[model samples]
Target: MVLQQRREPYPHWEYTDPSGAEVLRVVPERGGLVTGWSSLGRDWLYFDAERFADPDLSVRGGIPVLFPICGGLPDGRLPLPQGVFTLAQHGFARDRAWELSALEGGDGVRLTLAHDPHTLAAFPFLFRLSLEYRLAPGQLGITAQVANAGEDPMPFSFGLHPYWAVDDLSAVRLEGLPAEGFDHHTMAPATLAAQLEALGEGVDLLAHPAGPVRLRGVAGGAAVTLEPDAPLDLVVLWTDPPRPMVCLEPWTAPRGALISGDRRLLVDPGGCCSLSCRYRVDRGWG
Candidate 1:
C-alpha cells in the first residue's frame, strides 16, 4: 500500500496512510488547519460539524496552531518595547490562511504562514511559522518552526490545541504530570491532585520537564500519548461540556506570557526555534 494525497470537493486536502487505516485532512485556506484524523477505523480527533460549515465562525475543533502568544495578554493588547498593539486571544495564526509548501508523498504535509502587513500590525515582528503534519505507523507528529526574520530579536509563545474525542470526561484521567498547575482564569497556582475526576470545569497543567503525558479512556477504548519536545513548557487539559472531547495542549509558555514575560522564547535575529510533539494512539487494556 502506498500513501495517497487528494483534493476533495469540500476544498481541502486529504492524506492517507498506505494501508488506509489512518487518515488526515487539512484545509490550507483556513489556517492550514487539520480538521480530521482517524486511526484503525476510529476517529481520534473531534470536529465541530456546525463550525466547519460556517465560514464566518472560527473552527472550534481540530488542531489549531497558536503562535506569537499561547493564551492571552493582560488585556486585548500587547505591550512591546517597540509599541503597544491590539492582539486577540490565542493569537491570529489559526484564523489566517497558510500557504501549502509541500505535501510529501502523502506521509507528511508542510504548510507555512509568513508575516504580512496585517500580521505585522498586530505582532510587530517579521517571522515565518511552519507547521508540518506527519503520520507514521501508529503516531502523528506535529512540528512547529518559528524563524525570526526581523532585524531585532523576537519574543513569542506557541501551542497546539488538539480536541481529542473521548467516551466521557469523567472517564478520562491524565497521567505523567505534577500535582500542581496554574489556573489562568483565577490567575493563581492550583492543584490537580483530585480534580482529574471532576474536571468538568477544566484545568491547565503547567509544563513538566520530566516526561510525556498520556490520556486514557478515550473513545473506542484507546489511549493517546503526548510526547513533547524541547521548549514546550506547559500542558493544558480542558474540556468543553456536552462535546465529548478533551484537549491535551502543549504550549511553549504559560498563559499571560505576553504580559508576564515568563518562559517565553526569544529568537535572535536570523535564528530559529522549533517545538514539536508526537501523539501515539493504541488500543487500551479495558
Candidate 2:
C-alpha cells in the first residue's frame, strides 16, 4: 500500500509505488536514465537491453538525459570565452555517472550529477543537475533542476528523450501538435501529419504545441498524455521502424540552441532553474 526501493543487479535502482500501480527502474550510472516504467500491468517504455548493458554504446531506448546542449555543435566543438572545448552530441551528462538517493518520503528518487575534472575539460563550466522522479496512481512525474555554480552565466539547453513502446508504428495516433514542424534529417519545414504517416519508413520531427499532447493506439489499448511545464513544451517525435518504439520527447529548446542562442536560457551565478513534467495514463482512448 506504500512504496518500495531496492537496488537491483549492477547499476540499477528499482522504485515501485504499490499503491499507485506503477513501477520504475532507474540507472544512475546510465545518465540517470529511467529504463522502464510500468503502470496498470503494462510497460509504457521501450528498452534495448543489449545496448544498455554495453558501456561503450549510446543507449537506444529508455529516457536519456540531455543537458548543456541538446544536439551537437559545429565540428563537435564549442567555442567558449575560456577556450574551445570538444563536446560530443548531447553533451556529457548522458555519459556520466550520477549519485542516486531516495527522497525524504521514500516515495521517489533523486539522481544528481555535477561537473568534475573530466566534464570541465570539455564544458569549462561549474554546474550541477538534479533529477527527481515520483509516481502516483496513473501518473509519473519528473522534476529537473540545474544550478549555475560558476562565476559567470551558464548557457544551456535541457531535454528528456523517452522511448515509448508501440507494436505497430502506423497505429500511433499523436495529437496536440502544431500544423508545421522542422524535420531533423532535412532541416526543412514540414507538416507534422505527414511525418506520422511515414512512421513505417522512420520519422523524426519537432513541433511546439500549446496544450497537453495525447498519445494513443500503442501496442496495448491504453493511452498516454504528456504534460510539460512552460519553456519545456517543445515536442519531438521519432521512430525507428521494426524496433516497435516511438520517442515523444519534451525539450526546452530545439537543436543548436547553444550554437545559435535561439531560445537558449542562461542561469546566472548562484542561480538555479527548475523544470517539471508529468505523464498520465488512461484506457480505451484508441
* Cα lDDT listed for each candidate: 0.81, 0.84
**Tens-digit per-residue lDDT, 56-108, candidate 2:** 88898889999888877889988878888898998889998998887787667
Clashing pairs in 2: none
Q: Candidate 2's error at 167, in angstroms? A: 1.8
Error of 2 at 46 (Å): 0.3
TM-score of 1: 0.92
**Number of the top candidate by lDDT?**
2
The superposed Cα distance between candidate 2 and the true structure at residue 172, in angstroms, equals 0.7
- Name the regions of candidate 2 deviating beyond 4 angstroms: 1-11, 18-20
Clashing pairs for predicted structure model 1, backbone only: 207-233
Error of 2 at 72 (Å): 1.7
Top of the candidates by TM-score = 2
Query: RMSD, model 2, all Cα superposed?
Result: 1.9
